[model samples]
Target: MSTIQKDSAITLHFTIKLNDGSVADSTHNMGKPAKLIIGDGSLSDNFEQCLIGLTSGENKSIELKAQDAFGMPNPDNVHYMDRAKFVGDAEVEVGTVMAFSGPDGAEIPGIITDIAGDSVTVDFNHPLAGQDVTFDVEILSVE
Candidate 1:
């Protein structure tokens, strides 16, 4: 029975729920468990700490604050772009998520939050930002 440690390779199923009790994400919906190595930058330190001593076949529910979960939404992440930039077939409507090239050529996903004349407001913040969340986890294996 291996306990989760700093370098442990873990396999688990997780369900992330928002404060409103709506499901945000779940490996169960994907029909497969997720695997990860601790301290690999895939999860925040606060999130990983919750699994410090957990072993196989354990079930745990962890509650996280807004800041700890995804950090509060940053106002700086909101930008106004020219509506003309959204040309072609894609519809330009509020609540639409679109990806654009970043400075490093990586795709940055932004959600359209507003549209006014030639100005389109795009928010780059994580969709779950500023919301407290709960993680329901079932540890399948730890090595």
Candidate 2:
């Protein structure tokens, strides 16, 4: 049985739940295990640390603070864009999420929070930011 190490590629079923016990994300429901290499920056450092020595068929449940999980929300991530930006095919209703092009041409998801006569409030913070979370992981394999 191989233990997770610095560069270990592992497959695991995981679920992230908020402090209120509401699931934020889960791989088990999709019937597909997630595969990732440790220390690859795909997962947060605190999250990777929780799997440092686990072997195949092992399971762990860890609780993480808001900062450790998704970091606190930054006010600067909230922006008010001109309502004209959504005139075309973009939806303008509140609670709608749209992806805007970033500086490097990457898609940045922003959720519409409010819509006034000429302005639309968009929040770019990750939905789970500022909330403590619990991670339930079942290690299936380590390579």
Candidate 3:
């Protein structure tokens, strides 16, 4: 009967639904419960707050504002790249998610938002950014 607190190890199944009731993500879809420690920097502070005080075998539905969830889309994250950068078999089409190397050499995923002649607009913001979401969580264990 451990209530979730800071640094608590938690095992849970969660479904994230958009405002339109569309399933955005779900651990159940992955066929396994997710395990995480509170304040591990994985879940945002606002998201982690919703789990506080929850015990094992608890079910809760939490609604999060766009800014509180994945957060509002940052205009700076939207960049316009040269169409020439995309070569070879890669299709230059809208709605395609591509991974680009960051300054640190890490792969950063960006979605093609627009294509205008030689310019291609890629949005690096999270796909769910700027959208409010609902979290349905079933806590399997909390310690």
Candidate 4:
């Protein structure tokens, strides 16, 4: 069996859970594992550290902090825009997630936090940011 190492693409089953133990995501639930290349920045450095020496068919659980996982919510990502900016038949309501073209021409998502008269407050932070998360991993195969 090949051992998981840096830059190796390994197939594994993983579950992301909150501190409360409720699962946020899991491949075992789908009955299939996911494949990812090691050291590709797809997994956090902390998450990768836990798999460094694991071989095929190994199972382990790893915990990561906010900074090591999805990272802290950045205040700068939050912005307030004119409610009119969201024109058309769609109602500009609070808690609605909308995507708009950013300066880089890519679509950026922002959630409406408040709907003030002629103004809408939006936050673009990741939903999981600023929170610690845990990963329960089951190595299915390594190559």
How much lDDT does each candidate structure score? 0.96, 0.93, 0.96, 0.87
How well does candidate 4 score on lDDT at residue 27?
94
Residue range 1-143, candidate 2, lDDT tens digits: 89999999999999999988999999978989999999998988998999999999999999999999998999999999998778777668999989999889999999999988998999999988999999999999999
Q: How far does residue 48 in candidate 2 sit from its true spot (Å)? A: 1.0
Better structure of 1 and 2 per lDDT: 1
RMSD each, Å: 1.0, 1.2, 1.1, 2.3
Better of 3 and 4 by lDDT: 3
Better of 2 and 4 by TM-score: 2
Tell me the number of clashing residue pairs for each predicted model: 0, 0, 0, 0
lDDT (10s digit) by residue, model 3, range 1-143: 79999999999999999999999999999999999999999998999999999999999999999999999999999999999999999898999999999999999999999999999999999999999999999999998
Evaluation by TM-score, superior candidate among 1 and 2: 1
Worst 10 residues of 1 by lDDT: 62-71
Position 36, candidate 3: lDDT:
98
Q: Candidate 4, residues 29-65: lDDT per residue as tens digits?
A: 8988899999998988887888999998888888899
Q: Itemize residue pairs with steric clashes in candidate 1.
A: none
lDDT accuracy of residue 16 in candidate 3:
97
lDDT per residue for candidate 1 within 47-143, as digits (tens), equals: 9999989999999999999888888999999999999899888999999999988889999999999999999999999999999999999999999
